[model samples]
Target: MTGAATGLGLGIAERFVADGCVEVHGLDITPTPDRVVPGLQHRTVDVGDAQEVDDCVEAILTAAGRIDILVCNAAIMQDRHEVLQTPDELVERVLRVNFGGVFNLCRAVGRAMKDAGSGRVVTVSSQVAETPWPGMAVYAASKAAVTTFTRAFALEMAPYGVYVNTILPGTMDTNQMRDSFAGLGRMTGADPESLIAAKRTSMPLGRMGTPQDAANLASWLASDQASFSIGGVFDLTGGELWSRS
Candidate 1:
């Protein structure tokens, strides 16, 4: 699992471990403290770096013998700016980490899965890919790329019994979400709590989603129960996608 050190990624990794996965390897840029999960092994890796990602995958294979499931959840949401104000470097950096990371890992792990003839790849995208909130052009675009690429890749990998799917999560009460909201508030000179409360009220479900909600869906997607699911995008948006009120 990429980005398994925090937020949704950590939730997913925890679920996998709790589900009795023999070995769960978490790859992240941050240093994960020892024994975050009983059998979870943490590797500090910049997913944006292709070489680093490749080496990490190789190491996981060496240690675990096989990678039955891969969860691509490493991403960043930064510089909430309009396109005119967004820097070229920022765009490149976001794309490199958010989309390139997925590309590198999928290529590396997908090759291994192809050789093995069976594997599951569950990518965590965001509802913004389709919903298109302002000030999120770059992040949304990267996720859009991931959504489309995963679908196409799934078709290619289907012949080899590998299933690939994407998950689009809506507003969740994660540290990242809180941080992003705080940052946006700072930019807009608005109270973060007020902004967050407004967001909560905007959700048709009457509450913001939890990391566990996303983790539950991810766990399901990674299981054999989702065997027939392929190249599909699952939304865990708490009906926010349809709410315009």
Candidate 2:
């Protein structure tokens, strides 16, 4: 699992461990800590670098003998800015980590799974990919690319018994979410608390999602229970995407 050092990725990694996965390997650009959840091995890796991702996957295969499941969840949401004001470098960086990272890991691990004749890939996208928001152009675009890529790749890999699916999370209460909102609040001169409260009120379910909400669906997709499922885009948005005020 990429980005497993924190936020939604960490929650998913913890869930896998709890589900009795033999080995749960987590990759993040962040430094590997001395201690993580039991049964999870943390590694420092930049998924945006294709060579690094390939090397890491190869190492996992060499050590674990096989990789049964893969979760491509590494991503970044830098400060929000309108398209015209967004710098070229910021766009490139976001695309590299959010989209390129997914491509690299999926291609490398998908090949291995194809050869093994079976695997499960769960990618975390965002509801914003489909429901656009002002000042989130780059982040939303990157996730949109991931959503489409996963759908196409699923078709190509289905014959090999590999299932690929994406989870679209909406307003999850993760560190990244809070940080992004806080940053946006700073830019707009709005109190971060007010922004968060406004978001909560907008949700049809009356609350933002939890990381565990995403983890539950991801866990099912990664398990045999979802064997017949393929190329699915599961929404864990609490109906916020379709809410009518």
- Give the alpha carbon lDDT tens digit for every residue of 79-101 in model 1: 78888899999999999999999
Model 2 segments more than 4 A misplaced = 32-35
- The Cα local distance difference test for each model comes to 0.89, 0.91
Which pairs of residues collide in candidate 2? Answer: none
Per-residue lDDT of candidate 2, residues 61-87 (tens digit): 998889999999989987889998999
Q: Global CA lDDT of candidate 2, please? A: 0.91
| Model 2 alpha-carbon miss at residue 79, Å | 1.4
- Runs with alpha carbons beyond 4 Å of true place in candidate 1: 33-35
Q: Pick the candidate with the highest lDDT.
A: 2
